[model samples]
Target: MSTITYYLDMQRPEQIIGKPLPADLSVVECQHKQYQLNRFLYQLVGEPWQWTDKLSWSDAQWRALIEQPGHRTWVAYYQGAVAGYYELLRDAEGVVEILYFGLAEAFFGQGFGGPLLTQALQSAWAWPGTTRVWVHTCSLDHPSALANYQARGLRIYREEVEAEAP
Candidate 1:
């Protein structure tokens, strides 16, 4: 098997198509750098998609990433329940990357992906000195993941395919 990774980017905030969040769904930035919370969210929303890069990370490793000055997390709540989340990281070059994004297993197919992604893009652009916003998604992700990113005005800048060992 092979995994295909697509790199996408938006040169300007105006490029975003922007979707309005549903009344019952709201997203808010996590004001605290709680590694445990981020770890929980990673496992919760990434389970079905096979996200395992951080599965073996130690507490210190998680803390280091979460505590980075340019790292930020935002969670989406649906009717007061944790529905989804996204993480943004800005480099010194003024580029913001949507490092992680997804809906919880219980929230899939509920029309929340687009709006949540819109929030991600908007929030990325809101960062001071943001010159570009970007993200990457692979074939192992949700089928609509790439579509949703494109619908939000992110254009494909690169792609890669890697063979998976059995």
Candidate 2:
């Protein structure tokens, strides 16, 4: 399959504000728990093409990636069950990337996506020395992915088509 991916970035922290989450929904940082993080990644991005990056990694490699400094994952909970997650990676140069973001199938269409994304973006901006925040979404992602990022104030800065192995 081939995908046209859009890359987005926000250069100013003041450009967006976090939207309020439903009372029952909460976001928590995943604390060095590789197994749980892997499980969430698989379940949340279960659609075939959506999770290929991490799915193809060996256990050790996956753990090493997650353990790297400035790489963090946040899991969202709805009434205490895992609902979704977003991972962020910050490079030494002060650029933050929304490495991955998605909701599990069970949480889809429940109206939690926007708020969860808002939280993710807000958190990214809060990191010290962050000069920019960015994310990429392709055709293979959830239908609302790009729109959600735009709604949260990320603007498309570039896009291109690329082939993906089936």
Best TM-score among the predictions, by candidate number: 1
User: Where does candidate 2 stray beyond 4 Å?
Assistant: 163-166
| Model 1 CA deviation exceeding 4 Å by range | none
For the record, the alpha-carbon RMSD of candidate 1 to the native fold, in angstroms, is 0.9
Give one digit per residue, the lDDT tens place, for model 1 in 65-153.
99999999999998889999999999999999999999999999999999999999999998989999999999989999999999999
**What do the candidate models score in CA lDDT, each in turn?**
0.96, 0.83
Candidate 2, residues 132-155, lDDT tens digits: the string is 999998888888888989988899
Cα lDDT over the full model 1: 0.96
* Ten contiguous residues with the weakest lDDT in model 2: 44-53
Error of 1 at 60 (Å): 0.4
Clashing pairs in 1: none
TM-score of each: 0.97, 0.89
